[model samples]
Target: MASSNTTLAEASNITTMAGRSNSTEAASPYSFHFGMLLNPDYLLVEAQVIFSALSIIWLGAHASLRRPPSAAHAKPKNGKKKVKDVQFAEGFTASDAIMLPVTAAIVLVGLYYALEWFKDPDIVNRVLRIYLSTVSIASLGAAAGHGLDIITSLVFPGLWVDRKGTLYRVDSDHQHQVKVGEGDVETEVVEIKTPFPSFLSTLPLSHGKIQAAWEIRNLLTEEWTVRLAAHGLGLAEFSIKLNTLLGFLIAISTTIAYNTTKWFFLPNLLGSAACYSSFSLMSPTSFSIGSAILVGLFFYDIIMVFYTPYMITVAKKIDAPIKLVFNTGRGVSMLGLGDIVVPGMLMAMALRFDLHQFYHKQMKLEPIDLVSELATATPGETVMVSETQYRRVKPTYADPEGQWGNRFWTTKLGSLSPVSIATSVRAATAFPKPYFYASMLGYFAGMLVTLTMLLVFNHGQPALLYLVPGVTGSLWLTALARGELKDMYGYTEDGSMDVEDVIVEVDSTGKTIEAVKSTAEEKGETKDNKTGKEAVARTEKGEGDYDVFLFSVTAPRRRAPKRD
Candidate 1:
């Protein structure tokens, strides 16, 4: 993120003005320099740096650990269902990379001109704040929910379900007939079973009651649903689950407190949340796309910071959560959101790529065909139907149970534990992360250099100028050293690896009765479908077909006489 020294200059100007007004005691230059060196703002800057780095690391870890919605879900067991994760509709493309700098330049120039014409930055800031704050509220809420889950998992490992499973809402009055078999044979109809209330209330301290307070938390968490009705309705609805609602409330409270008291930490918290949410919502998808975006922004940052004043001017003038501002007791030290997000996206991609390599090269789990058999009985006849399908196995790394626990507590003085660490280092370093680690090292070094230059030169520096090269160079170097250039180039987050065969069973009326085995199931287990048919499904090595099967009772009619 860009660190600006414009505030330092302003602080100096104010000091000079104050001295001119007093014209009495002259402060010693040595004392002034010492005070600057010991300024509490320096600690604040360092804290922000650490906070930004940790946020980036967590963002990348989240991207790598999260599985697709279909893969994350588990069968409904005792009224508990898994919560699905939220993801962006589309991944960042190469075209987006190409246009990023151009689009940013246009916005910067437009904002600059608008400021000049209006002669007031507040007008622009107010307009932008309205839109940005609205978005930030949602983003902050989601990020907070995710962070809470992470903390809960780390502290109370295995205490909660891996997917944060919650109780499903029961509708006792709603019922549907489910067909049991294919139409060629005898068909049995069964009523859909309603799930029992969750036993969470049976848990200690009314934990179950706490969980029952929320329903369908995974609906919006996985993806956004859009609805349009032409009749008398013209509205768009977005849903937030319990955790998300809590986060939303927290964000709203923060906004209110900041507006009333002008607290600096509030904005920083909001800005950090926005950055984390941005990483979750969008990613470069691949190293190449990430590199292209960073390189483009590299030049853009240089031009905007060194050649023009729009960057700093806007950063200083805007009174929103777009930038992190630390009150240095003199003025403020600023870090623009762009400085963190642009390079942070690339770092996140690096982590994801590392995970990709780990799953393919280290785990090396092969796809297996799952075959299912179904039988239907009709008048004096029986028909047997067989279907084959394949599903991607969920990785151990994706499992939340004991995944984020600190193992250091198990280490005894007489013995050393393999994963002895006070932090979640065991989980964080569970997979080999050469590229991710390298990029992080580079990022830390670049930040140090940026801050050093800011002090030595006493001027604002474009952070991307250092950060882009540091991250991209480190990644390329690591790739080259590991002889993974080809793999890095070929790797993409297109959901192909995450795809699994889904078997949908339908009734004689062509209505879908149930979906069977969308994800991997334990071997040799018979899965009971809604139609009351127990299908023996097992994994094998062979070609498989997956599709919807509809059974009808009526036989095909004989061909009609020539259609003269």
Candidate 2:
């Protein structure tokens, strides 16, 4: 297989030669056109197409991964999952079906515009505006993805959740700790105020306690004021400020990438290569590179649409230490915009200077010269190529049509030769790890074949045969990556927790009810100052209120598999 370095080295030589040839003399009929490579519009068109594909794949991934929970108790009355009619946890609710894709679309738009404006938005007077817009788009995409997950868990109560029925006693903490009896501990109830509910209710992926509070506030606005005023209230203002910072970073990097490069092909390739290179510099790991590329690609497509909203939601829900959770899940030092920058710049330069034709010329290839070549071959042309053209185009030693060269093309066959079958069979048998490893092998084989064709064409004909690999590989890999993520994280409709269940208690002291439940009316009579002592004593002697609610939740028993 040809390494990127080899292809690049060859490309450099081609560039030098093409430059000399183009300048020294008049253009030859066989000379390649360099202008096609520099077309900025192609870059934009490619980006749009790929991003559009990503939006579809993301929707597909959502449908595949966070599948609706089973309706064991709440039957699908309308013969469907009734996604909008379901509610599972305290803070989660059934979101509109349109809401899911809309979130993704928003992210997509953000990415599109981010690439458009931020790519070159000079950091002058309105730097903040550019920054804000960029951050907003990225945050929206992140938030939408996460929010959709939260909503999915909410609507499909049967989805993964761990700690249910967990009880927390606020008043008990304040209860006087006094030894009541032998070998027993009791609290002296000096002030019998109703115990505030426990801080935690639902089991969030991270920062369950704090997130529970925000989730309650966001989804249950009616209970927000009361819930916030309850115990567990601390610093809210600072948290918002922190979230804005995260949004800022995400936005800025996205803008830089968009403004720097017209197309993502090189960025995707190089970022993926570098990502895999980290796992084993000498031996690239497919999953590492593939996941990085796929995730970035999906995230890239959704960047403009969902990243910001998702970031807001994540920032809110991440009531835990921002540094920790961010570093752990989404913010882990995974490949970011920086990884794409170098490649993006390389592509920009290549496009700006029409470098591809140089690479082709260096390899002895010709350029696509006419509109006819751009279109699919006509039936007559196809027949001619399949029959008479083969003899003329044979590498060498073609005497009439009955020779060895004629024999090679006499039998009608697809582009693939017998070597393809042999290579495929060998690749399948060579991998012992998983089917994906086999897939990686197949992908490499396909790339090798394509590269070989590019080399041969550049050496001989030089027509643009690159059309084959570019379109096929991009779409194929995108679909494959989405499918893999779905298979790994997807839920089933058979009411079962694939992971372990965490049992938490729910009693009078727990916040589960108060977080979502409404209030009741109470009446009392008051007298004058003469009854001050009596009133104070009565108020101090208030009884602690407690209620119990119990249910089960499924939490991950072990670290979930990230990649294969």
Candidate 3:
């Protein structure tokens, strides 16, 4: 009887242990080893460090940009010489664009070889940790490099070399014009030239100014084509690509470091120290995970949504008109949201210990009451709480139904809400159905492929890698490109082709836009002057407005004479 009781007790103990193991497996996003090794305390410390370092970098960059250049790359004092040199530097040199992609490819390839040692599981898991201690110091070096590059750009602003070999500069007043030529020879400066308005007025009845407009229009078209040929649309696109490459590089480096050595804590210690010491004063706790990981993601978003359009606006500030703010907002809403959603979903999956949890949560939260109740603002226009104070007064207004303006209403209404209504209308009447369907399919397919690959490998969480270029990267590429067409470039909120809807182009000589009917007639592109060129028509107020233009030329073009 005693022997039988012992056997039963053993069986019960084994079952209990098995159940706990299964529960833990279901809860952890990554492998058990990762959970055990990664100290949350260290992550918190690292986060604080990263934020501090980033703050210092930004502060230093701003200060250096504001001050006069004392560095070797500083502008020359004399106006003519400064312009000449600046133009030379800004113009697209042969090595500038080519080197970016070539260098990235080469680095990635080299890293792959260097990390062959990681193929050995023993070196990677047990011994490599020691080597990371030394190489982690290089992160500070990378931060320094990034800082220098930014300051250099700010100090020597608008030194862009075009394919036509021209240098343009932005003055204090924000006007952009060609500042430098091939050499220092100064041509006779014409203070009063043929005004653009006067040129427009002089067009003949037949093609009007189409011939004249073609001169500038052709160049503008070609420049954009060439930019695309370079495999990216703009600086924002370039940044995205480059940052991806940087992330891979960091991953490879860390992988190699971990594989080659056993004691990696030294580098972590130094990296954490540098990250914290530089950033702790002002930076947030999110930046120190790695030099490239946090900043790269944030920078990519900022570049795509804000910086890229702003640059285009600056390049064509004078002659062509484009709405920077609207374009920015659109980029943020569509592209930014799409990009972030993948990673965010992954994070949600990690939290729930199952990738399906993201979808489940979406479905679960659909009918729930999402509410936020705010107390009335005090008399002094200051909102004070237990641990925080604010100056802005909260609005008391709610929706027409007397409910708070929380996003829950939108979820509850589903397709009946304004956003869904607009999307449905676009699908029904305006947006190309096949194209929309194709893009949606591609996005979903990409996400599935990414998730499958991660599950197959049994590595880290998959969501973090979804935005990454690999198989997952291609998914976002199509979505972003399509979204740009469907969201950018169309009409204003009022459904008019205002100056804000224009696409501006700039090169070595000047700025230009697609020739309007009046100007295209002068440029000789359109032979009939009596009829205006047909602008792409847009749908009603609710339908989406996006203008994705494909340029045909290899270089930028500008108007010969400034229009009055």
User: What lDDT tens digits, residue by residue, belong to model 2 across residues 1-564?
Assistant: 112112111110001001111222223333335553343543343233334322322222222221122111122432433222222122111232234335545643453354455554233214433443343454333433333434422332110111241111122223211212222123232221221121223334344544343333233211111111222332121112222334345435555654455443323322222222221111111223332333333333234213333322222222110111101111111112222221122112112112112221222112222222332455544321221110001011101101112112211244222122122211211212233223333333432343333233322111112222332243345436656433322322222321111122234543222111111101112233337556556645874432233233222122221221
User: Which candidate's lDDT is highest?
Assistant: 1
RMSD per model, one decimal: 16.4, 29.8, 28.6
Per-residue lDDT of 81-196 in model 1, one digit per residue for the tens?
A: 34444565558888987698888888877877888899988887777766676678877777777665555434333211111221122221232122222221214323323112
| Candidate 3 per-residue lDDT over residues 1-564, each given as its tens digit | 001111100010000000111334445564433452244432343233223323332232222111111111124442322221111112122242344334433433343343453554334323323453344435434444344434333333222222333333222212223333333222323221111221232435344444444333232212132222222332121112222234345545654554455452433333432332232112111111121232244333333223323221211211100000111110110011123222222221121111111121222101112234446655545433432111111111111111111111112232332223222212212222232233234434443443343224332222223333322233234335656332222211121221111123333453332312234323545323323233212222334543354433333334353332
- Model 3 worst lDDT run, 10 consecutive residues: 9-18
Q: What residue runs in model 2 are displaced by over 4 Å at the alpha carbon?
A: 1-64, 68-249, 256-445, 459-564
lDDT of each: 0.54, 0.26, 0.27
List the candidates ranked by TM-score, beginning with the highest: 1, 2, 3
TM-score to true structure, per model: 0.61, 0.20, 0.20
Error of 2 at 226 (Å): 17
Question: Model 1: how far is 84 from its true place, Å?
Answer: 6.6
In model 3, what is the error at residue 63, expressed in angstroms?
11
RMSD of 2: 29.8
Which has the better TM-score: candidate 1, or candidate 2?
A: 1
Q: What is the TM-score (0 to 1) of candidate 1?
A: 0.61
